[model samples]
Target chain A: MNPLLRVEKLEVVYGRAITSIQGISLEAHKGEIVALLGTNGAGKSTTLRAISGFLGLDDARVTEGAIHFKDNSLANRPPYLITKLGIVLVPERDKVFPNLSVVENLSAPVATAGANRKRLEEMAFTFFPKLAELRGRTAGLLSGGERQMLALASALVCGPELLLVDELSLGLAPVVVEDLAQRLVEIRDKLGITILLVEQNATVALSIADRGYVLENGRVVLDGDAARLKSHGDIQEFYLGGAGERRSYRDVKQYRRSRRWYG
Target chain B: MQLAINIAVLTAIYALIACGYVLIYRVSRVLNLAHGELMMLSAYLLITTASLFSKTPFIALGAAIFLSLCVGVLVYLFLMRRMTGEMVLAAVLTTVALGVLLRGLVVLIWSAQQQNPAQALGWVNHSLPVFGGRISAAGAALIATTALVYVGLFLFLRFSRYGIRMRAAGQNPLLAAQRGISLHVIYALAWGLSTLTGALAGILISLDSGLDSTMVLIGLKAFPAALVGGLDSLVGALLGSLIIAAAEVLMIYYVDALLSDVVPFLVLILMLVFRPWGLFGTREELDRV
Candidate 1:
């Protein structure tokens, strides 16, 4: 069977000069959580933005390659069309409408075709009951953790087949991030929704993602099963921060020179 | 008593027209400088339709109002739609140019003559007594229409799904679009509603007094009320109209008759200096523009 989303050799350019991302490839099958882990400016967000059709606002475009969702090419499509086609994005920032009340924010997104809006809303509330309590509160007044929950819940309200979440644990407490990560797993298991999670928190992402890809400077350097990645030597030294021995700066430079020779 | 009545009548005029500016500005952040010309055009539409359906005055009014709604939508779809993704100042200047073009067209088509639709429709502007002050029939209608329009708008925006979507679009267009709301449709609807309200104000005013180029000045004066109230807040528009109307009426009575035309703007400048966002407007709104 084909995967739900297939992105092959995707290249994105900003303002015709700067190439934000190039030749990045990934795929997500139905009912799986795939994590794209990277630090700032690693092009994780750009990949997600390309998939979700949000690059237009910044005058960026998917200049090369293709994003195929359920065998349909999604190139140069508007954000609303991309959303309506069942790929919903929970953006990195400004995820919820600040001025609107929680209920209004949830009500604002158009549900997927043939999906029951009220049922989806109820499903969202079921996943995060805290949102039910803060139904009347303005979204701007919510704390960082609560806002993240609201953002996740509102994304669910769109009834998407593929959910693209950018920076799920950003500006969030560790405990809150852990809980949200767990809830995300629960949501995928219960709703059978495919998820592409972009995150700087590699540990949290790997904990929930079935598969993982590590990005650096817009290129995918390594990818493998989550458990294998967790135990890998490079991941241990860099992402997991479990580098056992303290090496000198000269030793690090020597290691980098050897890495380029083989990498 | 007379002073109070004058204030009420002037308040009705300003509030009625001011909501038009608020409606368009709030949704799209484009100030329709041609609103005065558009308002005048609607009155002229009323004249043509009234003559066509002279026996059925209500039908003529309805047809004219409906045509004005179409005009507003077409204006956005054909002209202002091109201005989307451009700078805010450019869009505003386009409206100014549209107003100029429309003014020349109105004179060319309708011939700059002072005419009364009520006379053609065979209706008298009867003076009626209310609370010890006399009110003309059209003046009373203007007050009632303004009150009804405000209440209807308040209810529509607060409770309706489309209204919530409109507010959503106004706050964040990118987010709104991502959520599956069409920005073009929302913007077009705003333009239609704004022109519809302005048309109503124009139609009623022309029926009260004779229609001429001077009607454009009344439309222009009402803009300060919208600004004073906060360009985005409907409730602010209402309150701002009352404040400016009171100032203008009082100034004309005691200070100078010529002061009436300038008082609303003087109040607008004061509001700008003290509270650029207006009374009920969000402070962050000042930076968005």
Candidate 2:
């Protein structure tokens, strides 16, 4: 099956000087949860920014490479236009409007026309029942986990065909992250919406993702099935913190520099 | 009783104009320094419109108000739109430049003469007895308009989908865009609404007094009220306007009449020094401004 979203050799540059993402490519097939795993500065967020059409806000641009969703080229499209095209991004932070109540936040999304907005809102509550109880509370006052849930629920109200989530587990406890990860899977299964989840938490991402890509130094260094990646020695040593003879600090960069695989 | 009436009229003027500042500031975070010029321009438009719609005075008033709204949107589309994502200071400086340009343009077109829109429209500004104090027809209108605008704005912002989206956009523009809300549309709507409220203030004030470049000073005076109330809060604007108006009227009555012009600024300076965020503005709003 053709991928629902495709990033072809995506190259992103920030403020005309910094090449934050260079020749990075990835894809997510329909109804699949594809995790783009990376550490800090691995260009995970930049790739997401490029796909979501918000690169211009930060003086970043897609210098080369094309991002295609279904057949629409995303370059030069505004963020709202990208969203109207059914690609909605749930950013890691500042995801919810702080002053708006939970109910208002859910209604704020300019969802696709003909979509049953009321039903979607109801479905959001069904998925994250905690949000229903806090519907009247201002989003700013909500706990971090509740805020994340609100953010996710609000994103769902957009009726996206493709969801781009940046740093889903950041600043959350292990239990909350796990529950959120499970909710992501449930959302994909029920809605059949393709998801591109960027994360530094390989364990949580791989646990739910069907396919995974590991990015390092603005390049995709590894790609594989989630199960196989879980068993991969390099993934174990570096990403999952698996047991291994500790490599010397000086040789660590050399070890990472030589890492590569294809799944 | 008369002093109370005077305070009400003055507060009405300030609240109406102050909302223009608050609307634009809350949405796009741009301090529209050109608001005074725009308000003055609206009053001037009434003069031209009064000539065109001479047979229908109400029609002329409506045309002038509508024209002002169009000008506000045009300013955004033609000038302010280009400044988006550039820098906040750059956008604000552009407004200052806009104000200077408008000041010259109004003079060039209208010839620096005092024009009475009420007379041109053939309307009488009669004073009526109210609660043992007299209030001009225009003064009463200003008070009514201010109350309606505030009530209308409160409902629109609280209950309307566009209003919710507007607040959402103001709070987090990037996220708002990601949710399919067009920032340009929201910003443009803000400009249009802000200018509309400013136009109402200008036209009513012009009807009460007369019009010239000096009318811009009224818009300028309204800014301190907005700041005192908290630039983001409508309730703050009304309270700030009341506080400023009361101070000015009392100072004029007790101290020197010349002090009336200086009192608003004095209150503003004191507010800035003691509580820069205004009465209800968020603490971190200082950084955003």
Fnat for every candidate: 0.54, 0.84
Highest DockQ scorer: 2
Report how far residue B50 has shifted in candidate 1, in Å.
0.9
Candidate 1, residues A23-107, lDDT tens digits: the string is 8888899999999987799899999989888523468889998999996899778788888899988888888889889998888
> How far off is residue B253 in model 2, in Å?
1.1
- Per-residue CA lDDT of candidate 2, range A1-263, in tens? 78888888888878889998778778899999999998899989888988988624578788888889998899757899999989989997899999999999999999877789999999999999999899899999999899999999999999999999999999999999999999999999999988899999999999999999999889889888899889988888889999577767787666644456322
> Measured against the native two-chain assembly using Cα atoms, what DockQ does each of the candidate structures obtain, in the order listed?
0.58, 0.77
Residues B1-289, candidate 1: write the lDDT tens digits.
9889989989999999999999888777889999998999999999999999999999999999999999999999999986654467888999999999999999999999998999978889999998998999999999999999999999888778788888888887777777777778888999999999999999999999979978889999999888888889999999989999999989989999988888888998899988998987877789853
Candidate 2 ranges beyond 4 A from true positions = A247-263
Consecutive 10-residue window with the lowest summed lDDT within model 1 chain A: A254-263
Against the native chain B, what TM-score does each candidate's chain B reach? 0.97, 0.99
Q: Where does candidate 2 clash, by residue pair? A: none
- Residue B275's lDDT within candidate 2 is 94
Model 1's C-alpha root-mean-square deviation from the true structure amounts to 2.2
